[model samples]
Target: MQRDAARLLYGNAVAGIMISLLTSSFLVFAFSYPRVDPLKKMWWFGMFILLLFRFIDVIWWKIKLQNTEFDGKKSITHFVIGANITAIMWSIYLVYCTNQVNDVQLTTTIIAIAATAGGSATVLAAHKYTAMFYPCILLVPGSIGLLLSEEKSLHLLGILGLSFAFVMLLISRKSANFTVHTLFLKNENSVLIDSMEEKVKQRTQKIYELSNLDPLTRLYNRTAFLEQLKRVTTKSEKQFALLFIDLDGFKKINDSIGHKAGDDILRETANRLNQFTSNTQLVCRWGGDEFLVVFAETDEKRAVEKSNKLISLLSEPHTTENSILSVGATIGIALYPNHAKTEDRLIQLADMAMYYQKKQMRSAVCVFNEEMEELFAYDLHLKNGLTKAIENKELRLVFQPIISSQTLKVAAFEALLRWQLKGKDIPPDEFISIAEQYGLIHEIGAWVLNQACLEVKNWNTEQEVIVCVNVSVIQLQDDNFISIVESALSENLIPPELLHIEITESVFASDLVVITDQIKSLQAMGIQVSIDDFGTGYSSLSAMQDLAVNMVKIDRSFVNKIDSNGKAIISAVMHMSEALNFTVIAEGVETQEQSQALLNLGVHYFQGYHYSRPLEIKNIPAYLEENQNNT
Candidate 1:
């Protein structure tokens, strides 16, 4: 502040000194030559020398201002004070010299000196005290000369001069105050604008960071990952490894413990990847339970090895407060030069490989191969044709009988979907997932419900047998799903008791309250609810209990090749069902021994290829009669 004040008032003081010097020299040269009193001439010469001294002082101060750095208030105050004192002394000397001259000489000297003070008032007005003091000091020399005046007229002139100096001082002080205030407001506005700009800069930076980074793991998000992939593929000649990593069985973790535990598992997975990965690899969260790792400098072999190491690292048990979580990564690797040339193709190939491992449902890394691409192309073709296939009535269903062990007779039939496109049967495993992925499951599910309810109602004269339609999780969540099911039953004139809505236990992970309400509403309408592939999910007993389910169908995995542990698990499940008052239906009973074993465990229902393969709707009546005849 002091330095700025000094700089501001500098021009005024410099102008004051220059005016004094110029005027004094002019007065001495103009009036001293013709007929001068020796004493008066000497005094005028002394005044000229004093003005010259004042000019030198002003020049020296300006040089110092350029040469030396003016710092804080104290040094600037001292410097300004010295300049102001010199100005006052010049005014005092001019008055003393004028008092010794004749009236004409005095009149001219006072006018020149008063003009110098007048200029100072306008120039130095921004400094209030300095402006006020300047005119007062100038009036001192004239006022003193008036006090010792020999003539009354001279005295009145001196008094008038004093009054004029006082008025100039008041004007200078008011102008200085106004100028100082205006400058202060401009300075404050400048500071405020700068502060607001800085805040905006910081906020924009933070928003950018959040958009790029994942909150939980601080890895790049899907958008950032894709951008990085595009940059790498487009700009670099180097071949990179794109690894798509999916955590196997993440749904069970979420179903068993909850989403918070699931988040912890994901975080642990990310931390393990970060620790095990090489520095060149950029790890990112592709989406839920999925991560993408890009290796910038590596070959097929090194990439495989790196991916395998990452899988091993993730397999290490992560001990959480709830339970020990051990998740495995199914890695899919596609090399930049070898497998794909574009970013989308690279991610697609890697994702196809990852999904291949996901089908196996364990820790396995697969490299993109020519065969995989061929298979992906076929799957893509099926996906493209599915909507058309649905419209053309190419979708159909066949029923597999569930036999009662106690009665050795058909109890209920499970409706299985089939897509026959141009005389070729697309496997349910392939088309079903594709339907779920493409959000066509709701329509497919409604079709299945309509067909099965109508067919079963035709055969159900005694109203004893039920038809079960397998539902996808997506179908269950569909907004009009309940209406679809209700319309199927009302149109077919079928009792709800003869229609079972079968869902995998994975549905337990959905909003439990909502599922419970939905299930209760269906049950209230006389519909039977069952858990299909029961043991395949986490089987949160609470969810199973809350579902108010009537039956629990054991997954094929438990019954296909039952070991002692599998048998024990099956037995425990059977006992649990009995305790819970649920009927047990065993699936995949391929051999007589498997059926007998389930019968031994008190499971009363059996369904597998051993009894009968899924038959066409037209063949069901003949097959039922043939089975009755055999029995």
Candidate 2:
């Protein structure tokens, strides 16, 4: 308030000086009407000197003090003193005119005093004391001088002058109150706007954190990593190496110990990476059990060295509350402007290299090469060809019979999808992974469901046999999967009890509550659910109990090694199946020895090439007839 008052006082100083000079000129001329007098001259000189000092003060304020942080109270005090003295000088001139000049001159002097006092009441209102006092000084003494004169007309004029001074004081008080109130409201509004801006900033920061950061590891997420990659590839002219790291056997450890211990391992991995990498290098938690690191300005040798160091760093045993867990990593390195120039291709090649290393040699580092590029291109070709596989009639279903171990009769058939493009066979793992990655699994899964239901309904077997179709995790999580099942069953007129939905045990790692609800809903609708590849995934026993699936198919990996302690693992699963009241089917029984061993261990069913390779729709009837004859 004081600053504003002082600024306003000086801001219009030139205008005020002009008005004062004009008023003083008029008074001097009026007082010196007949001849020049020393009194008028002295009054003119005093006014000129005061105006000169005020003009210089304003100039000095503009030059040195206008934008500074100097205290305004001192300036305000100086303004008040100068303003009051000027008013006093004008009052003395008014009194002199009243005593020495004629009635006309005195009236002119009174008019000038009234005008100046009224203008001051409004102009100086920023400071209440100055506004009220300056006008009073200009009006009070002149009015008293007129009232003390003997002239009757002068006495009436004096009374009116006093009344006008009182009115000006009231006007000054009201203007000053309004000015103070407006400034107070302005300050309050400023504070409110500032607070609102701060809150918006905080919320925006929170939103960024939620979107760009991984909540568990507090590392940059996939979205943030991709964004950074795009920026670096676009703006940077220098080369950088992109490292894709996958934690080897993390799922096995997670499943064996617990997810909590797995989470501790992941956090420790992230902490180690963050500590090991410098600011110039970027690190991110790309997804579950995988991380991405970018080394700025590097070559293949340096990248290999860094990759080895990272593998060693991550492979160290991590200590959780109840467990000391050890995990290893496989790193794939792809260089910018060396292998691929674009961000997508760079990340793709890097991931392919990492996958190659993981598949060939666990816990190692591999740099991308031309051979990997060719392999990636082949996969890409398969991915592109898969989109039209169904349209081209190149996609077909082959059913493998699940036989009863005791009766040696076909009990169920698992429908599997096959894609043959130009007579070149694409493995299920290759094409299925591509399908899931490119978001084409939903369409392909629905097609498989409908086709399997239609094909199984046409099977002319006397005994009713169930048809099991493998479902992807993506398909199960989809909101429309249940509806797809209903559509297939209703369209094909297949019995709901005869259709089995085979889900992998990895489903337990996902949204368990929702998946469990989905499983229960399927069971309620008379459709049985089976956990395919049972021992392969790290599904908890409690999750398995909660699912209460109808059947558990031992993964072929365990069956391939059935002679060497694989039976122990399968025996444990068999015991779990008996305790949980579910049946067990041993898959991939390519040898009679393995089959006999499994049957001796009390296995319920068998499905593998040892019985029959997956047969076509036309071949199924003959196989069943031949099997019935054998029975």
Candidate 3:
């Protein structure tokens, strides 16, 4: 809008100056003429007024040009040259109009020629196509009239000059219109380009944010965390801590509650973790229920303290729509430049430590140590051996008889796992721990459950002797474990009452609310659930009552030292089980003293090396037959 107005004012000034120059040239011609009449003087005065008006218009255009924002010196120079040419043209016109000359006829001819020459000169000086045509159309004809008719030349010059002036005015008008249209188009294009750039910038920013964030929890995802880990590790020489936390009982939560509720819990858990760490640490959703925390400039003690704080924070009751639930986390800490030199190694070491801690304590934090490296190496070796065990048929299920203490007869056999590496027996404790550590327990547990079910099907017993299999914490945590158990039962065509699933105290320690619900679901199918190594864990009396368990096996630690520390513990366990209406089984009985002590404590079942060691499926039939005949 502003640009169009400036162009209009400039064009008008050019037209006005052209009129003034023509009036001035006519006045010069009138002065050379001898006939100085009243009419001629009036004509001169009229030319003066036109020149004055032209000068006033020029001043007005100069003010407008001063106000206008010139793009460059080129536009300013163009306007100046056009204005100067128009001024010169107006002066020549005024000199011719005055009609004052020494020789009237000669002066009129000279003035006419001079006006034509001056107009041509003005057009050349202006260097404009529109101004060039004006001289040829108006000035050339007026100059030819001076050579021909004396009376008609002045009138002819006036008429022709006005026509040229109008032509110049029209050209200037068109130029102004074209200038306004061009500026409008350029401005619109500029705005469109700016808008596109802004949109691109916004989209790029959104993509960057999405790439770094976890979709489920809105926390920093694994990729982003690892990149940050690399940066922090590289810049700082000070030791930092990397904590790998895995939620205990998350699978049970998923199974008992729907996946939606489980996801809600996970998101809530992420929020809690973020709040707990705040700005002092970097908390990342490290896939599933696991999280990784990178603590800068922190040592082993501070890291452990932080882990404990986090554990304590998580242990608080979490409110869901269904119930008030409590969840626990097992944290594994690995120190920078101490436990590992690189970021990948550090994360791996931390994960290993966390799993080891989960296996040992089940719900406690553990730091990586040199001893852990040895244990990890041993576990790795066992994992390799176990992987090959299936191919070699070296992985075997051994049955240890759980005999009735009063009847002194076999009641049921607990299926224990044994691995033989090249005909040499590996202890159940050694390889079982390895299997759990390496996440191979699911496969091993399935093998044992299947073998035990098959063996139970083949057994010949008048009494309904049940086969119990110890399910690892890892196995219980598996979503497929229940399906595997159901399939095994169906494959063997054994009644659900004949099979019992034995879970250790540690399994209950993890996500107990979920574990109990899962156990109840299993119980609904008529399969028995027993707490193995019961007295060793921190199971509350209320929890024991709430859990739909059929039996509670007294831990060997309590059974072995029944006369000493075990006596009181075993007595308490038996009484507690009796009070809860749960059957009691005493494990690890090797001596008459231990046996007598448990019997006195009202232990109904006994399992030990004294009765029979865990045996192969082939050996179990003859042993059970012999024991039945002996009884």
Clashes of each: 1, 0, 41
Q: Deviation in angstroms for 117 in model 1?
A: 1.2
- Displacement of the residue 148 alpha carbon in candidate 3, Å: 27
Lowest lDDT 10-residue stretch of candidate 1: 32-41
Task: Please give me the total number of clashing residue pairs in predicted model 3.
Answer: 41
Instruction: Give the clashing pairs for model 1.
Output: 125-176
Question: By summed lDDT, which 10 consecutive residues of candidate 2 come out lowest?
Answer: 29-38
After superposition, the stretches of candidate 2 with alpha carbons farther than 4 Å from their true spots are: 1-64, 69-74, 86-236, 240-335, 339-372
Which candidate gets the maximum lDDT versus the true structure? 2
lDDT of 1 by residue, 302-398 (tens): 9898888888888888777658877777999999978888888898999999877666656988988988878778878888888887689898889
Q: Which scores greater on TM-score, model 1 or model 2?
A: 1
What are the lDDT figures for the candidates, one per model?
A: 0.79, 0.88, 0.74
lDDT by residue (252-367, candidate 3, tens digit) is: 76766668877888988888888987856788998988999888888899889888999988777777867777678999999999988788999999988997897688678899
Score candidate 2 by TM-score against the native. 0.63
lDDT of 2 by residue, 1-631 (tens): 5676678878877788889988888778655565436878888899989988988888888789989876789987877777888998998888887778888778888898899999987778778888998888888888988899988779888888899989999999999888777767876787789899999999999899999989889889989988999999999979889999999879767755678988889888989998889545788998899899999999999999988998999989888967777889999999998998888889888999997787679999999998987887887898899899989998999999999999999998999998898998888988998898788999999999999999988989898989999999889888898999999999999989999999987887676766888889899999999998887757879989988989998999999998897989999988898899999999999999999999999999999999999988889999999999999
